[model samples]
Target: MTLVEGAGPRTGAPPEPLRRNREFLLLWSGASMSFLATRVTAVAYPLIVLWHTGSPLAMSVVSTAALLPLLLVQLPAGALVDRWDRRRLMLGCEAGRVLAVGSVALALAAGRVDVAHLAAVAFLESALAVFYRLAERGAVRNLVHPAHLPAALAQNEARGRAAGLLGQPGGVLLHSAARWLPFGFGVLGYLVSLVTLLFVRKDFQAERTAPARPGRLTGEVAEGMRWLWRQRFLRAALGYVAGTNVLFQMLALALILRIKEAGLPSATLAVVVGIGGVGGLGGALAGGRLQRLMSQRTLLIGGAVAWTLLIGAMALTARPVLLGALYAGTGFVGAVFNVAAAVYQVRITPDAFQGRVAATAGLIGSGTNALGSFAGGLLLTAWGALPTVRAIAAAMAVLALLAAVAPGLRGETAATPRTAEPVDPVEPTEKPVEPTEKPVEPTEKGEGDR
Candidate 1:
């Protein structure tokens, strides 16, 4: 893989910032709207499961089915992403999801939808989302200068949080109005995304040497896993996220049950949950600046600390407003952590390996989340809501503390530093270079700045 070089002499005037980059604008706007719609489905899916099956267990099962792709499909999908054109892969995934989710909408219109149907559609949509995300991650490096990676990723994070801030409540309210409404809009969003993707001018991925036929897939997957395993800091961060996701998923299930038992309307529960999204939105808007001030390590560990305190507080409160406040605090911290992590990952990973590395991290992180959903369902079934939430909150707090002290994560700088003097741009070539056996290590010189 070629190392990204700094900018060289421009043919005319200097290259414009991504703000005026038409291709990047199209990519960003499309993805922003699509993510918003996806969030709608994310919230609506659970609500539909609960409304139809009226079982927390059923909701969890459907959620697990949706997440199961992260566990099973991520590696293969990542390998394919590295092989395929990222723009095409993203386009295809978006198109596939449109069809899959639209089918659900149609079934609802005909009044023929069921839990089994929901599970199948959810699985298909989520699997597509995983591929779509990996392709997007892989494509970002190609869409802008290396110097702009942090800002681009931070903006992307903000886009997602904005979607969450609006979509979660919007989904619930729409579902309350009509079950099919969210999915119908989801179709429209994808259509917009598809058109925008068609108009993007730049290449979204670099060329790669095709691996020899037979055992390539397994080798590629193993390569990604090995790369991640060797990155001590990233691996530890993965563990931290995975652990927190488990408890958070459990907490979500418990919160739903608590609202139900309290006899609150679905809209009330939606508002409480949606309040967290506001914090997320605020955090995303600030993440670029925050990373400039704090080291990546600081952000990682500090986020852990914030989560521990916030979740612990959650255990002490049954009031919806108080719980909402705690959730918002956690979201704010989580958004910052996400931006830092994404920037670091993008900076450190080579273009050729981007898809695999992203997929590997996501596979492990999301696999844990899926397990959490399943365990949450069973735990809530056996122990009920309040006790289950308390126990899990305590566990998550202890784990966060452990992560803060973990050797891999404790000593790294908060943000990667950007280079000062510009260097020549590396030209794209078809010739294959020798693949390095050594894992890519973080440099003492930071590659991220405000």
Candidate 2:
């Protein structure tokens, strides 16, 4: 376990769980606000472009600009997160987003908005977000006790999922109300996040061993990649997620095609897709409890199997109601799987590696999303929707079965249980507790012997 220096000793009762923890509540609220803003702007950006240019190409360019940073910035940003003070990094990112979005609103108000300006704003804001997300993921490891990790991460997942579910429509509503309203509201959300950050007194980063050399940033990134490459379970999990992401992309395209084939309204397709968000929210809320009840293996493997079944069911029916139900079911499994995977990763990884690990994982998953979308377009055009859906579902089922039986998941062991830092009740100082139990190392049975 890692600990900050200058912590003398425990004084009184243990620190309360996150629900009652002052710092945690503030952080959670701030993060939620930021998420809502980001989500709103995600929809608003394209709408702004559409309003100005009335060209589908303009909308695509602006939208693609936001996603570019995920592919390009995550690995380098993760290394920077490890080197920088996380609290300051988050503050800077939020402040930058506020400025970026506020600028767009101001431009719109002045009737000076253009495609180039929107693209620049989108790229810059998203680049900052890459750093902010990595920093936040690392900070949570230091913010609360090990027991609270599951719940904290679960809540975090719910925040993102909730934003995804509601942000777009909310943005459209606000845009309809006024062109500048969505970005204006987004500015307020970031302002709230900044204020919350200002109030947080605790340090959000682990003590660094050495100052990061700008010259060695490349070496640092390579080191992070190597560390991730050595972890057997995470390596397998990344591959699984990457494959599923590709399939999910196909499912999304298939849904649109299916709706058109059935002579359903476009609004019906939106409702069906939107229902999946509720499933995600439900799963995230239940994640901590499910973790406490089930072994990591059970939750992950069961989620995989469930995902296969739910997505496969889509092959048998095109009824809108059944399709929505199937989508929701898959979303639930995805949430549970994500929570379980995050908990495992956080617990097993040392504090220093959190940023890079998160970056690597995120990069791979996100990179595949682009590929998946491209592949879905091709497959849908070539094979049509029904055959494409069934083929992908069958392939996913085979992969899930293989992952379930893999050695990394056998025996249902907790992945490298981390020692929770005992809180100093009087001072509110958090330090990592030393591990008393001899948990299995990552390379047990020569599994990670690469």
Candidate 3:
């Protein structure tokens, strides 16, 4: 009944396929519903605000509120996830999101949708989502056999891309029908996720031999930061991912600007972005196979180089179709990189630190997105679209070169060995501690991740 961390499939035995894993299915289904709903509402927020207020500044304010959680709530939410029961935490998040989103629907139905109320709901829903995601990231390792982790995470990556592909279009269509429809759908999605979690039977973390003593919130957050800082490969990988994320955000804005400058129809922009999403989804589907064939270092370096070429290609084209094709290539490479990075981070982190570590990485990777958007606007205003894109491509080239020469990436292998070490709550130590209890065969009661 007791499953050990990092336990692989038995020798000479094929690993159990994920299709037959009930726990994983439930977890994946729930998380997928929630993620899709989040994206739908993400689009709906700006659309509804614009439709009602007709103020770009108001729309921007609401959108910014939605993203603020990634910066403000991640660390504390992560610390809380590690401290609380992960499954229960996720349940609470779902419940809170249901109410937050439903309130928006109710307000819209009653014709009382104020900008402040909308912004508050946006911030609350986003903050709860942060908690749910961190807990879900930790829960994933416990749900599947170690050998299946790559496939599991790959599927998760695919889920996210698919959501991105569908959610915006769906939101637009639903909003055209009724302003409250998207929020109503979001409420339903969270409800389904909540119901599914209630049925999951497996523990979300390894059984602790002793109860952990609660520490100061700041101290607990610091523990995760310190632990992550000690991992050379992860630190380097995070840095690389963060830098690329900022550039990609910039590139996204530039693409829109280019389309506008060229007087392309709005549908052209949709086609370009949709094609890019398809590419990301395809890459995610292939990520598990690709991970088996390439080392983490190769994927990182190759992806960076590929992105440089793709972005540089975009700078040469004002044609919508050509730009879409190049953007698709970048999306493919980015998806593969994300899968590899997520698998590596999850495999090596101890269950206890999973939330904080995952949160910290999320913060590092996505924290600068607003900056990138702001910079993209400034650069476009100052130098124009093609020139701005050329600058982004040049910056990406620098990142590619860094990936190639970074000392931390030099020793990375195709498969990272399990290096998780137990942390003593009262007196934390840097060294690994051997478990006194032997690991037993895993049971089918409950297991899976998001």
Q: How high is the CA lDDT of each candidate model?
A: 0.74, 0.77, 0.82
Worst 10 residues of 1 by lDDT: 421-430
Better of 1 and 2 by TM-score: 2
RMSD values for the candidates in order, in angstroms, are 6.2, 7.1, 4.6
Q: With candidate 3 superimposed using the best TM-score fit, by how many Å does residue 240's alpha carbon deviate from the native?
A: 1.1
* Per-residue lDDT over 62-106 for candidate 1, one digit per residue giving the tens place of the 0 to 100 score: 887887887889998887887777898888988998899999999
Error of 3 at 233 (Å): 1.0
Error of 2 at 298 (Å): 2.7
TM-score of each: 0.79, 0.90, 0.91
Candidate 1 runs further than 4 Å off? 1-15, 42-64, 106-119, 172-180, 209-215, 254-268, 374-397, 410-450
Model 2 scores worst on lDDT over the 10 consecutive residues at 441-450
Model 1 residue 117 distance off true place after TM-score fit, in angstroms: 5.1
Per-residue alpha-carbon lDDT of candidate 3 for residues 6-72, written as tens digits (9 for 90 to 100): 4434353544677787888999999999999999999999999999999999999999999999999
Better of 2 and 3 by lDDT: 3
Clashing pairs in 1: 295-414, 295-415, 296-413, 296-414, 296-415, 416-446, 416-447, 416-448, 417-446, 417-447
Summed backbone clashes in each candidate are 10, 0, 4
